[model samples]
Target: MITSEKIKIYAHYYGDSDMWARRAKSSEKAILSNDWYLIGSLIQEIELVNKGLASEKFTLNLKKHLIESCDNQETIRQLESLLAMNK
Candidate 1:
């Protein structure tokens, strides 16, 4: 749904449902396999791909959602620690 009103699911390539589905599955697989680097790269792509105001806001909220999704305190702390250390 690439339009002026609706923010695209993904900003790269084709922003369609199928691509979004693949991204979700791939991210899930990466998580299941402890492929942190791959998932990190994927997330980084979100930030990189979004350039518009709406897209930027969506990506920001997406990042917030990801952080909020972590229920474990230690995991959250580790994520925060890693983010803090990021150059």
Candidate 2:
């Protein structure tokens, strides 16, 4: 599943409210129990979902890292440009 497809799935699953409620309930139980096993599994599932989504238009694993890096680089560039103008 591409990112867009996963996003659509997420939207549908969340938008309906029923499925979302169930998911929320299960997650809450897991949290309350302090179940690291469940938590770890949930994290892996979310990561898989994200990976599927990002892979469609992005390079999968590096999507978030790249976005963060790009944002950082852009900020630095803008700061340097501003400083140059001030000088």
- In candidate 2, stretches whose alpha carbon ends up further than 4 angstroms from where it belongs are 1-34, 53-87
By lDDT, the best candidate is 1
Q: Give per-residue CA lDDT, model 2, range 50-78, as digits (tens).
A: 45653543444344433343335443233
Residue-level lDDT tens digits of model 1 in 1-87: 012111112333133335455665554433333333433443454445443435667677756655554444454343333332233
TM-score of each: 0.29, 0.23
RMSD of each: 12.9, 16.7
In model 1, what is the error at residue 41, expressed in angstroms?
Answer: 4.4
What's the lDDT for residue 53 in model 2?
51
